[model samples]
Target: MKWLHQILFLLLLASAAASCKKFLNVEPADRTGSNSFWKTRQDVEAAVINCYGFLFQKFNDFNSPVIPAVGDMRCGGIGGSIASGQLGQGFYTLSQNDLSNTTNLGVPERYHLNDIDDWGPYFESIANCNITLAEIEKMTTLTDTEKKQYITEVKFVRAFTYFYICRLYGDVPFYTQPYDKTPRPRTSFITIFNTLIAELDAVKDDLPWTATNPSDLGVRACRGSVYTLIAQMNMWLAGFDKANQSKYWKDAAEKCVAVKNSGAFELLPIEETKRIFKGKTKESIFEFELNRNYGNTSLYVNLGQWMTHSPIVDYGGNSDLYFVRPLMERIYPPNLPDKRRDTWFYLPYSNNQTFMFLKQINVADPTGYWSFEDNLMVFRYADVLLLGAEALANLGSNNTEAISMLNTVRTRAGTPLFTAGAEDLKDAVFWERQKELIGEGHRWYDFVRTGRVTDPNQIITPMTQDQFDRGAWTWPIDAKARQNNPEIVLNLYWIR
Candidate 1:
């Protein structure tokens, strides 16, 4: 069956290639046997779906090594340790922290960084979209309206790709067109951001509120996701680029309100919300859908179970790591109710039993292995609300309204209301986000966005020069990528 599928895919590629000259005088690596593959409305729809598949492929579990290597989540198991302090030394080594280079500690342990060269996968996905869009533009089979909608969807995905790279690497070699010429010069952070914002805003009105067809299942880009990205990008711009701080903050606040008023989404109830990480909720705005039967391949691994396990259970069953630090657990206010506390951590007593699993793995089978249905949420309605509240507080003159918006999140979590001053209210919002979004990979970005890593009270621990040296904020460019393209500059913030 796999071989049959491969043959069919090759035939489709061949068909696509045969028609490439009709659309653009360029040849794709794989040829489609004939032009019939993308000559109909359904054909164009399938092409858009192929673009989405590329998006998922670029970031799926096969690429899981990059998450811990780049993101701020903790790493290590019961007896296994991350020599430089956090789990995975890719970021740490780039940051130039002092760790034993003698053993597989610092640079030597980072074998994957050497292997996965460049942002090729991400760019390849973008190129796929560009090629598809170019084909669709010349496709007369699809109506004008159909072409407009499909083009909007493709542009949204492309913008998201650039946004993802920009957030991670800062100034990257930005490209929207197919790489036919020598690589274009790297765009500055400011120009890249402006371009992203323009692209998103231009297509914002063209996207549908929701996908109307099953074929559009994970294919079409919706207003909610684009607005969410806009809010995030605006927030980042406000923080990192001070000259444009006010403008982007205002833009973020408006985008947040747009999502708030869209009426297409709502927060799941507390119980259902807890099941969200497991991928059971309707509130997910955008999630990477994983299916075990989609070849029984492990889509992505959950670090939560591995991160919080105690030594007793670490060596056995599905558990390998345990929570070594109290940073996440301590972020919640001491008096916030049990629901909030229990949601974030396995209570000490709960983990006291030798045979018990210390943390919750969203989907565990009867025998206790991690289930494959667990969906990793990239954006959810709850996150949108929190972001809205933060944006409002940052740019608007409504402290009371901000508090009310925040209390909505707290009330849903069954926690007490926050009555702190404006500054404290900001802290309240920050802490709430940390607690609510823990383990979902937002904490480190929050710290960096606010420039609060060094704040004594803001972070769970003081930001050590060692931590900074370890590239906690900036991800290391893959070593081989730099070697392949000498123009690729390592992020100086992370480099020693």
Candidate 2:
């Protein structure tokens, strides 16, 4: 009954009018008349829920696994090859950074991920947040405290949406007002991030440190989530904005330290891998929910679809992909004692189909195709800890604190503690991130922001300096974007 109610609400949201003319081609409100809506608490709550629902649809687009294709495959996690069918072919195209030719890539069903180029989904989510923020003020039914909290939560969603799309497209039109039809050009991503950082800082404390209600735990925005977002944005700026790298690194480290000291999160034991990935545990800072029984299941959204097989998947086939053996060993050497190597992989160094990534293997029906039960983890505490370590290492003087943060995650993974000097600390943190956050979809972006995508020592598919400068890292903007707005410029790298 609860699931049915949720579905009904989502259907209502889907009924909002869509346009092909404007920058964001959708109405912000649900099907209900905006003039009469937001008069009651339930209406406000429903709109808030719709904001999250829009995000879920954006990430869980059934046509293609957008997140992994955008985030992980480009990192060469599939060893730049795969034995599986067309799916592997698709991932191979992504691995080689051959994104502009996705349409021509033979396996049209699996390889043509034009949706990744479309900014509509992200804008739809942003529009919802914008309207909610605009009209929530008119709600006399809710108290000031409640209004403040909801505003901050919606702001978090909007900020996160801008951050995500900016990373993908490099620069995007910034919008805040509801039902904004004005055509606008892409703003600098650095300026947008800086604006968002301050806006988040202003409203962060309004949200609770964590959700007290069990249902809201990781799905709702919290202070910890806000802090982590700020830290991540700062770390990203640290790499690209070299003039102020030290300030960005320091800010990132401080924000991460705040999250750690908040005592609201802790890393789960290495043995509780299932619990950790199942999501909404103490480890999760923020995640989008997906329950098998609740009629929410995403095959393309989970790594289990491509990484698990046989007894684990009840499919009489081998894994669709495996990490490159050299990269795997580079992160987890045979001589090293890493519980992640043992617990997360069947054969850490296997180049064949027997190599299975067990981190996301939680399936409800081994024999059925739609059984992936793990929620889409957007941020977890361990990822924040590692980002903190990376930021501190970049600061040059915080080597000792950086090692302390790195060791916290390592100690949980039963890996050897990092006892290295400042010179080696940054790569150590980077490798730890590769090992800790693999398949959860942070790999490719990490390489780009860290400026390690061109470092042959770090990346398997290093882009050249000229390629990097020419926007090889960004996804191509869909031609549809320029339909209504001549100001909309597509990523020229993909124009050929």
Candidate 3:
């Protein structure tokens, strides 16, 4: 499966370049669309494969915390390599609680990730999805089921990408057909959410519970994958919309139930964490598939390479990023014996100031440094259970069901079970997620949704409920992106 991933990665760039057509009004630059060319099933698959490249560019092209910046680091519990030299200061500054003045972070010698907009990559991905959806319907060679499957898969990925955009940017460019619209104002979040839920409902059953091959586990959309995302979206909507908490909470819980009934996933025990992050397991619902050697190009494991520099077997090297030891030790649920603390990180220092995350440390190269085979987990059963717990808590008191969900996730991780009431149970669920999904990129959103995002250092100020409500939690659109599209305006709070 990892080897198949290598093939998929190669297709992402090579086949996509030759097959994908003009999209998003960029002068049809790389488009090579023709009826005869796109006549086969391979053409449609190639187009879908092309969409993955944009996401890979954001993560593997460089060691950008593009994923973490908007997800984990902003949660204010981050600290970076205090190594002899400042190898990764950009991440350090971001973790230290400053994303506004990235100049202060100092440009790295290599992998200079410009101010956090990186919107172009996400939009480019969206455009590809749009192109695939628009053209795949017209093909006469495929059966109705194949046609529906292709359309639903593309639509699901687009919705998934847009879901992330809306969370970080609040509003964004939304389109179904590529090159059909002009540069427009950002679409409202409510409109996008309503559209996504409807689209997911229409096609959720159309997807299989699992793919025939191991490589397609999360890389390709399945019934479990689609429902999990649908469930996750409703959970966010409950937090963002606020007024219809009961509606969204119910929707979220129902979707989670759909995934559970599918019987496609399970909670892997702590001792088997290698299978969890190596991905394509009973525990994994969706993961970003990547391999060490994808031919020709060196494409090393970016996550492990950037995070650490330690030369330990099944671990990382040049360990650059870490959690502030004392605060995390304080917050990681005392006396609970959470095994993740050991599997996910190591305390090799006497001062105990840093703890390196070891989830992606299994593979290594000839030099004995961590290699690129580890698959990044996006959604797993544990996440679903925790979200279910969170949604159940929102339903009100006397929710034995919700408390059981919390206990299920906790017990698997070798942590204490929840014996508390509804309110306390909700708080336990929230903190449990913080420990469980720490570096996998869900913390910041969880913090913002629960109104618990604050400066653990006390130096960086917290956004008030008023500011959070006003859509002020989003990142400023980078200047370069604004220069490219005149219709794109700035997030007002960031305007000087």
Candidate 4:
């Protein structure tokens, strides 16, 4: 039960120490109770798992569905209400980029929409990662190799957490040392991304190309995940730093190419939707696990709760949400022969009442409990392939390689290969990602990183350059964020 004790300790530490004073208000490292727990390999493993657990708790907070709310729904594509017309007001405001509305109108307290504004959970998780990284180096039980791997694993978790928060909040206070509590101002996300790129590049080779254990596949950090994260960070950096855009694009393309050539991952047939979405598979690069049999399942965190109706989930009559018709048609024109359209949806072009998305329909108890049975796919092979295609296209050469990567995903999805038809290669790659990765909490970030957030044709809620320059794309940091840290600041646009 030592692992259980370690898990409990981490959970209690995260909860008890949650604050905004230099990201967390923890006891001095010298006096912390966890100092005694990091003495064995099991303890290290437990801490690593706790790192991921903290993230899971953050994403699965109450009924928030934080990922999709911030990543997908905000793009202004959803058209229907969950039930009462009042319940949709907060979501509607969110979709319109109105981040100041904490009341959420008719949204009940149980739903916890405002949790999206809070960055404390992420910092708490990052704190755990920092603690584990500092403590692991002193342990004598692990060999240098074992210690290196464990250190790299914790680093990945920390870097991944930072990358995620950077995407959401833009600039954030960056810290790597253990239990450093000095109040620090937000660091340029560019600087953080650059540091992460170098840090990950140095340690990525230490991880195996793939997890040898089936259970750990996609659920644990691997070389594929590390490369994918680096590739993504490069693309994001490229978006904000225009002067070195070409260099970042090339780096992204190269990292993605490494993932492709590794032979450790491949796109599962689009028809194998359940196997792919159910978690550990050849297609998944990284995902968070949720198995109902283990009494670990979430109703609101997964998209199924909002996108499915009666047969899929006994939710009375209609689904709680539906993709806008224009957006649906734009991505999947009726004339298109993409299997994703047929395989992932019912009534693809239909009205809101009956248009149900089936991409994540693994219901644990469809007729009764109605809990979702799909892992939160943070990264997958197809996503990497598409990102590679986008990066290659941005570099303006290697057009053939770009098209090949783009078409590989298309071929698997039973869609026509790209031939540089009327659609530009870059646009084709972008639309392919929108089509293939729809409903998986990616669309909004895709818009922001690609400069499509200001393009009316690309997104429903487009932002003007002036607004975007003022941080219109970021969520409002909760007032609690500045409670103890005087150096902390909120997003300017949200305040205006």
Q: How does each model score on lDDT?
A: 0.58, 0.79, 0.66, 0.81
Better of 1 and 4 by lDDT: 4
Instruction: Tell me how candidate 4 scores on lDDT.
Output: 0.81
Q: Can you give the lDDT of residue 21 in candidate 4?
A: 17
**lDDT tens per residue, model 2, 282-342:** 9999998777655566676766566778888777666767787887878788998889889
Ranking by lDDT: 4, 2, 3, 1
**Model 2 RMSD vs true structure:** 5.4
For every candidate, C-alpha RMSD to the true structure in Å = 6.7, 5.4, 5.9, 5.2
Q: Compared with the true structure, what per-residue lDDT tens digits does model 4 show for residues 147-202?
A: 98888888998999999999999899887876667677999999999999999999
Q: lDDT at 63 for candidate 4?
A: 44
Candidate 1, residue 364: Cα displacement in angstroms equals 7.0
Per-candidate TM equals 0.79, 0.92, 0.86, 0.92
Residue-pair clashes per prediction, in order, are: 16, 0, 10, 0
Per-residue accuracy of model 3 over 1-496 as CA lDDT, tens digit each = 1122223333333445443222101122243435345677876776665665555555544445466656766665455545534446666666644556654466463544454565766776676666667678788988888888888778788888888888887888676665444666678887888889998899888878877677677677778888888888888888768888788899888777667767778787888766777777888887666554442112233333345544443344445555665556655644547777767667723123245566665553535333445666678888998888788888874367778777888788777677764338777888788778877778778876666654333213366666666555777777666654677766766555
The residue pairs in collision within model 2 are none
Worst 10 residues of 3 by lDDT: 20-29
Error of 3 at 308 (Å): 3.6
Error of 1 at 39 (Å): 1.0
Better of 2 and 4 by lDDT: 4
lDDT of candidate 2 at residue 380, scale 0 to 100: 95
